[model samples]
Each structure stands twice: as structure tokens, then as C-alpha cells.
Target: MVLIGSHAYGKLPDLPAVAQNLTGLAGALRHPSVWGLPDSHCTVLDQPESAQQALDALHAQAPLATDTLIVYYAGHGLVDPYTDELYLALPASEQGRPDTALRYEYVRRAVLDPAVTARRKVVVLDSCYSGRALIGEMGAGDHVTAQALIDGTCLLTSTAETRKALSFPGERYTAFTGELIGILVGGIPEGPELLDMDTIYREAHARLAAKGRPQPQQRNRNAGGLIVLARNRAHPHSQAVGAPSDPTLTRLAPRTVPLLRRVSRRSLLVGAAVGTAGLGGAGLGIRQLLLAGEKDAGGGVGSAPSHRTTSPPAAAPSASASSSPTPTTPPTTQTSSPGGGAPRKALKPGEVAWRKKIPATDDASDVLLVDDVLVLNLDGTLHGYDRASGERRWTLRHDAPFARRLSGAAVGSGVLCIEDENMFLQGVDIRRGTKRWGFRLATEVDALDAMPPCVRGGIVYAARTGASLYALDLATGKKRWSYSPTGGVGANPTVNDTVVCVGVLDPTGNDVCAVDLRSGREKWREEFGLIEYLAVDNQCVYTCAMGTLTGLDLATREERWSQPGVRRDPTTDLQPLTLAGGVLYTTTVDGLLTARDPWTGTVRWRFNVRYGERFATWGQWSSGGGATPIIDGQTVYLGSLAYLALPDEAAFREKNRATHFVHAVDAATGTERWHFEAGGATGTTAVDATTVYVASSDGYLYGLAR
Candidate 1:
């Protein structure tokens, strides 16, 4: 990989500032990993004597067939308005412009010669009106002179002739260069067959759109036989042909209401009665009364039957002296009344397939279903439970005080990676849950908390609150590389094969960055002001900043599109968003659940729950709950406060405080399906197809079944 920039013009009076331009070029050059390669393999050439010299060096150090090559230039690029010939800037010796700086065709001739040994070549150009510099002209076939010079070369340039490229003061690189770096580092990795130039060009184009910059254009020349590998299969819903089908739709057996929703109403009432009678050993004492009602309904009696009388059953003993004694009810049963009546059975509370209590002193903070293992973060330890049985398998302990606050956990190569608020990175044996290694990053930075760590291949990437990024080995916890953005990193880093996408807060603005996972070099950078949350699927990266949501093409670091004015109240802070089944779910500070279209950014529906006293006070104490909303298929789950006052208001006033309720809403219509008072559920809820699990601050984990 090579980076070339020539901004150091000596006393050039008419041309734009070259030194400023070259500085930006150098920053990009030194960071080779940004181009999706290991830093050890890259070289930078700041000022070349001639196009021949630059080409000579590139070809002389030919890369192996297995290696990928990337070349980038950030300087003045001009084209002959008539012939549309491209040229790159060179240092001028005098105050006047030099006609012999460097022709685009000559640069192409030097670099594209088939004599070069590299298998794949990517060229990025950032210049004024750089779009016209691409190899092919408008409406022309792929075989331009530039394309004919090299085999398997891809070219990306700034803007078309009609659109102006953006440059900012104190920016080491222009928007184009920044966006290119963002994509190169973070773009998804494709297989050898898909590693072609045209794909890179398309990825870059998308990144620019997200940055609110003029869309970059590409001209494909000699790409007929080239194969551009895709990092992930295209989304089945994408406009692109041959999109991959969603496995969730294909693999799972169709839902059949699970035999519970089919029960009749009369059966439910009988089951409830039987359960009560069994506890009291009343021996079907209420059967006669129930049968009499049926006879009247059949018109067998002139007037309603006299009410039956029965003695109340004795109360059962209490488990504790501080609480009143309660009856121990027998499980309900299906039974028939007299006169050969139809049988009835009440719906039973769903069975508990399995349950396990956390250590008495600890509580679970999060649970992740990774393959067959259920990983739980409880107190300050990580535990793995069998998903099918909820049986504890193993446990790994970390020394960080705030380990319970860890948000993200990913598994790779049989190693589990986790990040804690203390900026501690922990890696554990996935099967045994034994601590393999751990590292404390930014020991001197007090505010530096590491976001959740994501693992790809054998490497783990994490972002820190202080604007730092770290790549570590999955097995050894060794630091591979680190990068600091102009702003601090707050979002969890996401890793595809080649790039690591991170959200950062910088002096210019809050932005998302794509860094080369191998070299810690920035591949692309796109700025947004006050970014809040980020999530990525197979095809696009979704981010929320201010009140708006934006989607960018993951491969190009370009914004494919955006949704502005999302109508969120300024006072309501948004929590991390979750996307599943083509829907995006998020929560506002005031406890409203909002769902929107992931592609179009249109709100599907919003559900609001009335807050009770405890929730209102908790919001006042903690700013607002940062719990992310949960989604399972077509249902959205959220926790809210519901207050109920005692009838004797003066007496036991303190005991009648408000309670928290977990509400399950239908995703399609935003209507509440069921509301259960859970009492002080301060954290997020988790769900499988049949059950919803939530934790309460009152020291319990409640499981409710559908």
C-alpha cells in the first residue's frame, strides 16, 4: 500500500495551498491499515520527483499475488476541460503554476503497467473536480486507456465536474480522503473472487452521501473479468439481485400458537376452581353450584337457582413471620361437572422449562444467546449457561468494580471477549469460562470506559470513552494496535473482516470512523454532530445523531441516505437502538417506545406508558433510564412505573409506594398486549420466543410467559 500527496508548492501564487493539502496526505499515508492491510506492509511517498519515479518504486516493490495494494493521493487534481485528461499536483519551484506537474495519464501509465506484481490495486484520489479524472468517459465502455494499463485496478475520485469538493480548515484530509479512509478500514471483506475495483468505488460513493457531501462517482474500465468480493451476502430485501435470504425466516419452524392460545374460556374458569378446591380438599364441593347454572342457561328452570353456600377453607401457614400466611394452592386441573357436561380446563401459567438463581449477592445485568451458550453478566462475573436448560456451565471473574455494567460480549475462536466500565478488556475460554487474559487500557484516563468489545476472525476491537480504539489478540490480550480520534470514542466498535467501525467524538464533530483492523489506520471518517447511537446489519450502518437517523453503505463509508427531523423531544435522551426483522426499535428518556422503518426512517408507531411515582422519582434522580428497548419478533417490551395508592391513605402511606410495570406491545400496531407490575425493573429486558425475562432492583429476576 502507498499514499502519495504533493501539497508543498514552493511560492505558488495561483494554485491552492499545497502544503496544507500534503499534510492531510501524510496523515493518511502513515496510517496504512486504513486501507485494510497490516501496517507493516505499507509505504508513504510525500513528494515524488516525477511520475516515473513514483511508478518505478510502486512496481519495483511488487506485492505477492496474495497481497492487496492500495494507493491514495490527496492534492490538486485537474483535467483538461476539452480532452478531459487528468493530472496530479507536484511541488512547484516558483510562484507561478507549472504546466509539467504530473499528468493523470502518466501517473496511470506508471502505476497500471502489468509489470507490477500486485494482484489487487485500489486507487483513491482527492482533488478539486476529481471525478472527471477517472479512466472512462461518460457513456463509454469500460476499456479506457487508464484501465488498459493495469489488470485488476479500481479507481475512486472525489466529485464530478459540476459539483465542488469540500475542504475544511485544520482538516488533515478533505471530506473525500476522510470518507475513503473510513471505508477502507471498515468496509466488509470480500472473498478473492469478489475483490475487484468496482466494489471499492461503490463503497466510497455511499460514504460520501452519509457525510452530506456530493456523491462520489466511479468509472469502471477493464473490469469485465474482475471479481469484486462482497463482505456479507446482500440483504434479501435489498434492491440488488441475488440478495441472500434471511435464515431466521427459513430455518425456524413456523409458530403454531404453542397449544396455549387455543384453550376455551369455560375451561379456564373450571381450572381455577379445581386448583382452589384441591388446596382446600373440598372434594368438588362447588361442582353442584356450577352445574345448576348450566341447567338455567338451558331453560330447564323457571327462575334462577338459589345460591349455594359453602364454608371458607382454612388458610395455609406462612413462610415468614413478617408476612401474612397465604394458602398453598394446588396446580389447576381439567374436570367435568355433573349431568355429563362438557369438560373444562383453565389455562395454566406457562411451565418453567428451567430456572437458576444468580449468586445471592449478585444480579444479572445482561444475557446474550451465542450459539447454544447463554452468556450472562452477573454482578462482576461472567457466566455461561446452557440455553436449553438454563443450567450453569462455567464462570469467569473480572477484577473491575463495574464489571456488572459491561454492555457488549462477543465470542470468537472459542474465546469470549467483554468490555467493562473501567476500560478493562477481558478474554475468557468460551467453553470453560476460565480467565485467559485481561488488559487495562488508559490507566491514566479517569473517564475512559471501554464499550463492548466485538470479535472478528481472531482479533478483538473495543472503543474507550476517551476517544481511543484498541485491537487485541483474542487469546493473549496483546495490543495489536490503537488509534485516537479527534474526538473520544463512545460507541462499541463493530468489526467485519477488514474494517472496524467505531463512533467517536472529535473536535470537528462527533462521527463514525472505519479503521483498518490489522493496522489501526483509519480507512474512512464521516462527521455528524452529537451522535447518540449506532447499529449495523449486513448491508448498512445505522446511526442516530441529534434527533435524526442516518444510514450509510458499510462498504464505502458513504451515506446511502438519511432521515431528518425524527421528532424526538430535546429533553428526551435516546437509548441504544435495536434492529431486527426490518424494524428499528428505540426508547426515549420519557419512556416512550418508538419503532421505525430501517430503510426509510419512517416511524411505524410509538407506545407510551403512564409513569408512576417511583419511575418519576427515579428519572429525577438518574437523569433518565438508559435502558434499551427489547424486541422479540413482533413484540416490543419496555418497563414503566405504575403507582397504586392504599385505600386508607393516612395509615401505611409509605408502604403504598408506586411499582414498576413491564409492558409488552404489539410491534405492528403499538398496542399493549399485556401489562404486568414487575416493580422497579431498572435495567433492560430480554426475550426468547415464549418468555420475557427482566431484572428488578428489588432483588429478583421475573420470567413471564406468553
Candidate 2:
């Protein structure tokens, strides 16, 4: 298997951050499974080149009889407003508008042409406004003939046109790429039975959507013919391939410490039955039963006599205790508290591993792990940490600081890229944590209120706060190209091999655009007045607009299918998307999180967090505020604020004060796991294998052990 990326990070004036993200992407692709085809048969091309050169090389390569070829991109995309044509952004010094960027038609003709290869081709895009670029009609940016390609092409994009893509502070790639790497690196299961391309695309889209960005879209033309070779699978003969040779696999191993088992099977069954009966209705009873299974085993109703009394008092007696004489001293005589004596501290400093303080800022937005480094965005400064020891490595501060609010980061090659509230792009060195270059919009604009910048190849793609989009180089901080809309650019851009896609907001509503990465030319544009977010797969681009979600063809930008009744508001900042275990997860402003079918957008399960109590006060014109949902395997995390007045009348009048609470839920089924109260939490949450990390307005970073 081979993966190739053609990314343009706009221009390089002084930003090394773009370069860092690109470098990190290169490193991710360097994994053995991605390019180690039996005997190292894969090649990567991230160098600067003209659209013609890139297409020519792709066309020249001989078709493979049996194998897979994966092509990826991270840059700018364009779309033609009149004809809905798509294009890819490229490095063109002469052309500065959207009319001259690389077109998708050209890419199709040169690289995806059916005659060029018999092997399956997989294309992944991490650019702004990528959905529009994939399937729309060829336009001025369409520099190549349309009748030049064959079939068996697979396509994937980061977001739809209406939503923005993000780059967190420490991420080596955009959220899309980070998730992709996570999937490829075993964060997601790999196998023919685990998930197909369509499923993966849908999951990826949902995951992104939950975070307030559009989901990645996909298109698979060959149905079952498109084969996704796992990127992290090792050779069968490798030493790590077989079952564990250690005794721990079959028996206890040496030096192993034993953990106490807290709950018994009888206790669990009894607790579940009682909890179920207490919930009242059948649906709630079922929900409670499920919740019972998820609760801390030792903390269930069966373990507490007082909890059972709080209900109708018809609860059954403990099953275990009924069979034996009750001890005079109760269960406390049999077992001690898990903590022994004192209440355990929420988080110990030693458990912190490492900590670094932001000079003058109190808030940070995103964090990511690239190779052995941890990157953090603290207010306006970008900090790097040694992943192993959590030691401070370096820091990069913005010379012309925009907003104190930091957004996201993307690391490539050796550069670290980040964005601010004003949509300013900054690039830094990963090793030294020093600023390499930076760029400001010729016109002051904000891409989307909370969206982050994305980097690919050596280009950085960012959406201004108003309505303009830009692509810049990582090394020199030069402006490669820019795109402005009659409406504002609301969505972040997603880049594939030869195209970029973004969402635009006008007085009438929302639309998606496909742009060329190299020349800043547009290929096609599609309008959906109600759409808010987008996701891509190999065969189609999925979008959520108005109150519905739909899929569009990648090659022709035509609507393939539509799923209705999926509505979200503008103030609902996060994308609310996640993909895992062949499922797409999304959250809405109404406090509902859903797991849906990626192909059809049908609801699989819906989880509600609303508790019928107003939690907090809202600014003028705002209904309510909530954080985006986060998913880790079978667990989902959510945070929100609600208000409650001292008097019922005052509360009903919306005059009550509110408090915030953080919740953890099960991803497979909509069930609450645990909840912790806090002042407020913004942005997304991060997780390691053993703990969950969250930041709040209370001036404390919380570490919740799993």
C-alpha cells in the first residue's frame, strides 16, 4: 500500500508551524504499514510542484495488477459559484484568484483516469471547503478534460462547505488527519469485518461534526471493490504478530500486582432489576437497567440500603444478604473503604506528570501528541512538551497577537502551526519552539468563530472570521492564494489530492465550494441554505444543512442522497462529529447526542442530556450554551450549563442563576456513566488511556481517572 499527499500550506512568510504540521503528516505516513509494501514499495511526494507536473507523474505511473494506492492532501480548495465546479489549490505565483488554482477535473484526468491504474486508489483531503471540490462540475479551474479517467477511485474529505475544519495546538495534522492517523494507528479497529470505507467516512464525519466542524466525506464508486489496507498492520511474520508469548495471556505474570474485584455477579443483577423498576416507564426502565450495568459496580443500589429507600420503598432486599444472617456491624466490618481513610484528592500534582504555565493567559484551547511530543495552545502562545516526561520543551508567542483566545494546532514535518480568534496563522519550529514565520489577512477576517487552521504538505489553509479563505506557504510565509465569497466563509477548508472544499454563508443561507489548491481557482460550488457541517468519504461528501444531512457524489458534485430532520443552530459552536465501530456520532444544540448510520443518516441511538432545569444565563439573543461532545471508544463525554432559580416562578421566568456540569456517557448505547459539576468547560476534551483531561473557567485543569 502507498499513500501520497499533495498539500500546499498557502505561502511561507515566517511561519514554520505549517511546515511542522506537514512534517508530522510525513512522519505518520512513514509508518511501516502505510508504505512498507512487503519490501518498501511506497513513495511519498510532498514537494512543491505545478498542477501539470503532479498530474503528469500520476498519469505516467504504470497500473498495478493487485495492490492499493492511497493519495492524501492538506491545502486549499475552490468551487465555481455558477456551475458548481471543483478545483484544488496549488503553488501559483502568477495567479492570485480562485480562477487559476488546480482543478479537480485535471486531477481526475491525470491521476484518477481509469486507464492509468487497475489498482484501487484512495484519496484523502484535509483542506477547507473540500466537499465542493470533489464532485462538482469542472470550471475555469478545471484545466483538464473530463473524459480522461476510469473507475475504482475512492475519495475522502475533512468537512462539507458550510462548516469549518480545525487544527488544535499540538496536533501534527488537522483534526481530520489526527483522527485518520488514530484510525490507522489502531485507535480504531482494522479488519475487513470491523468497518468499510463508507463506515469509516461516516464515523469520521460524525466525530468532526460533534466538535463543531463538518464531518469528513467519502465516495466509493466500486462498492465492495474498494479495499482499505490497514495502515498499522504489521507483516504476519513480524515478532509482534502472534498471540502474546508471556504468561499474562494465559495466567498471571511475574511482578504483576493484583487488583481488587469490587462487585459480584449477583449484586449486579439485583441492582439492575431494582434500578429498572424505580425508573417508572418501560423506556426509562430499560435505560436504567443499562445505566446500572455501566455504574461503578461497588456503588450500585444493591450495595446501598439507603438508596433503595429513596425510591417507592418497594425495592427488593439484597440477594446476597438475604441468604445469610446480617452481621451486627454491617458490610463495613467485612470491607474497608477503597481509599482506606481520607477522601482522595481530585488530582495530585505528581499524577500531573508535567505542567507548564501560560505567561499571561488563563485559557487554552487544544492539545495533541505527535511522535514523542505534546503540543499545547495556551491562550495565544504555543507550547511543546516532551511526551515521555511532560517536560517543557519550547514555546512560540505571536508577534502580532490577534485574540487572546487560542483555537487549534496542526504539526507537519518539523513545523507547528496554530490559529487565533482573529484567524491569524502562525508557524513555529517543533524542536526549538521558536516562530519561523507568520501571516495576517490582507483584510481582517475571522474564519468561523471557533474553527482552527489546517496544514498539509507545506501549505496552511485558514478561513478568516468574515468570509475570506487563504492558503500560505510554511517556509517563507508567502501568500500563495486567497478566496473571497459574496457570502462569508463559514466552514473550514478540506484538501484532497487536487481540490479544496469550504462552506460559505450568504444572506440567503449556506453553500459549499470546491477550490484548486495550487492556483486558487474554483471548480464548482453547491448551495444548501440550511446546511451547517460536512464530512467526506471515498465515494461521497456528506453534509448537514438546515434540518437535514445529505451525500453528494465526489466526481460530479451531484446529490446522491439526503437524510432529513437533522437540524442545528448557528450558536452551536462545535461540529459534534465522531466515527467509530462502523457508527457516526453527532450532538445537537438541544442537548441530544445521536449515533447514526453514515450511509443513510438514520438514527441508531439518541442520548439526551437535558434535565428540565435551566442551568445558566445566556447573552442577548442566545438561547443556551453547551460544549461539543467527545468520544473515546465506548465512552462519550459532554459538558453543559443549566440554571435554577431560588423560586419556581423566577426560574420559569428565566431569571435564575446557573451552574455547569460535565458528564460522561457510553458511546454504544445512550446511557449516563458519571457526571461532575464545574463552573464551565469550553472546547473539546482530551483523553489518555487511563485518564480524562478537562479545563474549566474555575481556573483548574481536571484529571479524571478512568
Candidate 3:
């Protein structure tokens, strides 16, 4: 195996995700000395030409047929919107000029030239539009199995062609590469081998989708056989976490300390029963699980809830019932809570409260509900509808005709705040459908997602993709203050202890700048290997970086404690860390939802969001809040779209039918209560006291009874 990255761009501000990408994937390999094959080298190239030269030399090496040759590239993959042509950016890359970048299609074909005798030739890419590396088009980003082979040539990518690939700001890898490394280092849970590319790709595709990232694409067109590399070696592999090493981390070997949570088999089995309840009439018609964390002497996760319905659900109404052209009235759901007119429970087992197709152009943003009104930002318009009836109430728009898509959105200060396509932050009056204010940064970077920015004290703290951290006055849309510690600021600004902490990343390294909210002056700055994302409470800032989960004192900026390689299951997406009930709630890129003791960084409990698949895990989303877990009361709701790679698909499908699911887990004990699988739910699920609103990529905004 060989690794090479070209991120030290001379013209473009360096693509730092590349360096982090190669390091994490290359770190776990035990070399020829350990396994005794021709040595697998991990190399970082300075420029595109240099990387190409190195790869050419590898092909020239031409040794024994027994050896397997691998090539990995992490940088920019550009697709011309007009011509649909693909190009890979080199260090000297200047988008749109010829001879400035390498043609990926040509290079991909070059790698498989028959003269090279190595039995297997693998090409892995992490860049924008990398999926185009495969000559064949992949309709879905999540799963691709090799159909035919011409030689020992195969390929894997970070994301599909239309979307950009993302990296954790302070981690050692991009989403796809990190997950690839994890799968390589940690073998399948109970089984032994983790070698097959097909197996690896399936799991990686699923993991990326779990966290809301563009699914990785794999095309093993030529490899005739499984190429096995490395062993299932396990040890206490502790990371210095690639930074200005801190005493809090160095004092203890991270692995020696016990994990805060462990997987509860009994609770999980019961949870799966609830998740699969509607799959068949045989599937239990359970409504909810027990309120978790109800402890006995053992202090274990709570038991299954008592909301069970033995009867089969009523037949679903015709699709026209909700979509028909008729004056609407709030439909009533029969519930035991108080008046039967209002819905008080989530969807009953096998029952569809209502499913209406949205003529929506984009499904990236979620549905927001406030009282009886539901809001959805679709195709440059914010459409409002009646929560109970799904009737259109109002529509707001400010974009040029058919020219806009949303990055993300939030509701605050009586306005529907949105980050628009041109990097403009706009606030629209929610009730009147009028634009209050719009602010566009001078830079060209896109502000994709970061929980739609934090709103407090009449100012909005916003972070943008092209690299900027600014505080805007909500009333006038004027910049209160601006900070750019690094060229790229992708994560959101978090406020706690009266200080604003923002994580920035570029080729230099990952740095967290703590600025005094009042003065907008830097109070302290910490440099780490990388900063993935941060969540803060009154005393601590929970950080998921360097493949480890750590906490930093909010005021002092001192490390409180750290858990190295926290999610050891070969899954890498930006793991979301949240603070609730004095415990940290986290969801991994691989679908493990966990509760941890904040004081000690000890895990309290673990629940697999993918539900009951044996030897299965989660997928990812490009970071900035799409897949982050949201806590509503004692319940945590998440949208899960899992890809199952099973030994027997028939058996697995019989038990669990839907790959796309929405689940509610107990915040206290991390026990899942109920799961509803409808059209694929994409992001943080929005809810009100009476209804759980979910926006699906399948063009429907489901109004489930809650």
C-alpha cells in the first residue's frame, strides 16, 4: 500500500484535509518488517507533479506478481458544471485553467496499464467530485460493488460527483479516509477478517451516510480476487493526538482508563424489536420503550418501555387523501392523552399518521415547526404549512429564479435565518414573509452548515467555509467583529463561559481560538493535531478531534480529560458531541450513540443507531450539523440511513426491512425506544410538543403523530 497527498498548494490556500487524510490511513499499518511482504510505504508528496512522478515510479518498480500495489490521493477533485469534465487539483492548481491540474480519468486508466506486474492495483481518492474517477456512473453514493474486472485494478472515493468531500477540522483524516483507516485497524466486531475491498467499501459507504456525508463510491473493476493486506493486529495504540501535547493527555495512557459506556446487549435486542416492529404483522406493535436510566442496584441501562399495541395497524389511506386539491382541516389522531383531537404520541406501530409528497427541490435543510405552523426552506423559498393538516400557509423567497439552494437554517429572534448559496446570511420575518436583513461576506467561501450559527444578545455568531468567523448585528446586518485565525473556518462558533470558541483548519494545523464575546479579541488559542467539532456546556468544551473525544475547560482552555481513538470501530465521520443531564451525549460517524460522564470523560452507555445488524455500523454526512443528535426532553431523535452488508441479505431483510430509519433513543441510558422507517430522513429531526416533523430526501415532509 502507498499513500500520497498534494495539499501544499502554491497558489491555492493549502487543502489541509489531504495531509490529515494520508496520516490517519497510513498510521495503522505494520510494514513489511511485521507482516513480511514488500514494504507498504506511506508518503506525503509536495505537489501534484511530484505525486504523479512518484506514482509513475511505483508502476515502474514492476517487481513480483504476488505484491499488491495501492495508490491514494487526497486533494481537490473539480467538475466543470458546464462540460461535466473532471480534474484533480495539484499544489499549483488554479481552478478553470488547462494544464493546471491533472486529468483524473487519464491517470485512472494509466494506473491500470498491464505492464505493471503487481497482482492488484488499487486507487483511492478523497476530493471533490472524486466519484467521477470511475468511468462508470454510480447513481447512489453509498454502495457500489465491482461488477466486472479487466485486471487487478480497483478504486474508492470520498464522495460522489455533485457534492464536495469534507474533513474534520482537527482530525488526522477526511471522512472517507478516516473510516477506511478504522475498518483497517479494527476488524469486524466478532468476526475475524476486515480485508475484502467490497466489504470495506460497503461499511464505509454506510458510515458516511450515518453522519450525513455524501456516500463514498467504490468501483473495483479489475481486481479478480480479494487483496488482503495487513493483519487484525490489536494493541494499545495511543495517539499523541497530533498537536502541542498537553499534560492532561500525556499523564495517562488513554487506553488504560475504562470507557464511559459499554454496549448493552439486552437493551439493544429489545430496541431492535421496537425498530423492526412495523416490518411485519409478526413485528411487535410496540409504541415506545421504557424511560431509560431507571436504575436498580446494578445501575444499568433502563428496560424496555410498556407502550405496546398488540393489534395490527389500520390500513394506510390512499396517497391522494393528503395530496388532493381540497380545502384542508386539521385531521385528528385518536390518542389517549387528554382530548383525542391533538396528537400526543409518535407514530403507532405500522401506522402512518400522514405522508405527503413535497414538491421540494432540495431536502438538505430540515423542517422547522413552531406551534401550529411548519416551515421548510426549499428551492429559494421558505414554505409554511399547517402542522396537522399539511396545508400550505405562506411562501418566502429572495433568490434569483431557480438559482439558489440553502446551506443550512435556524429560527431565532423572530426570524427564519438562512445561509444562502452566495455566502449571504439572510434573516426573513417568519410571519410576514418579508426580508429583514441579508449579509454577504467579501470572501467567496460557502457557509454550508454549523448548526445555523448561535443566536444570542441580538448578535449572530456565524462561521463560513471560505474561511471567516464573524459576529453580525441582527438589526443592521453589520459586522460587529471578525476573526480569521486560519484560512478555513468550517465549524460553528460555540459560546460558553462568555467566550466564543471557533475551530479553524487549513494546511498549517488545527487551532481553536477563544475570543472574548464583548471585545472580539482573542483570549486564548490552542493548537491541536486537528479540531473536528466542538460543543460547550457551562464548564467544559467537548471536542471530537484526532479520533479522540476530549474536554477542555471553558474558561481556562485547559484539557480536562481525553479518550484516545474513542470510536475504535473503523468509522470516521465528525462525531457529534453534546452536553445534557451532566453527561455528554455523542453520536459517532459509525452510528454509535453514547452517553458519557462529563466529569471523567467516561462513557455511561452505548447504542448502535443502525439498530440490529450484526457486524454493521453507521455512515457519515459532511460536517456542519446534518447528522448531529438533537435532544428534546428525555428523548434523542436522529435520522438514520444505513447500508447493510450482510452474509445473508434475505435473513437480514426478513428481520429488518427498512435501511432508511428515524429513531428515538433515551437520553439518560442511550436506549432506543421506537424507530420509524419512511422516506430517508436526512438531518436533525425537528419536533414540537405534539408532532415530530421529519424532512426526507424522498420529497416528503412527514408529519408523524408525536
Indicate which candidate wins on TM-score: 2
Which sequence of candidate numbers ranks them by TM-score, best first?
2, 3, 1
Using Cα atoms with residue i matched to residue i, what is each candidate's TM-score against the true structure? Answer: 0.45, 0.47, 0.46
Error of model 3, residue 520, in angstroms: 0.8
Worst 10 residues of 1 by lDDT: 270-279
Q: Is candidate 1 or candidate 3 better by lDDT?
A: 3
lDDT of 3: 0.49
Q: Write the per-residue lDDT of candidate 1 for residues 550-605, one digit (tens) a residue.
A: 88887776777777533245655565556543456666545567767665567777
Give the 10-residue window scoring lowest on summed lDDT in candidate 3.
270-279
Q: Which stretches of candidate 2 lie over 4 Å from their true place?
A: 1-366, 370-411, 414-416, 421-423, 430-432, 442-451, 465-467, 485-488, 505-507, 564-584, 610-617, 620-667, 670-682
Question: Candidate 2's residue-wise lDDT over 285-376, tens digit each?
Answer: 21133223322211101011110000000111111112111112101101111222322343321133223333322332434434334555
lDDT comparing candidate 2 with the true structure: 0.44
| Candidate numbers, best lDDT first, in rank order | 3, 1, 2
C-alpha RMSD for every candidate: 28.8, 18.7, 26.1
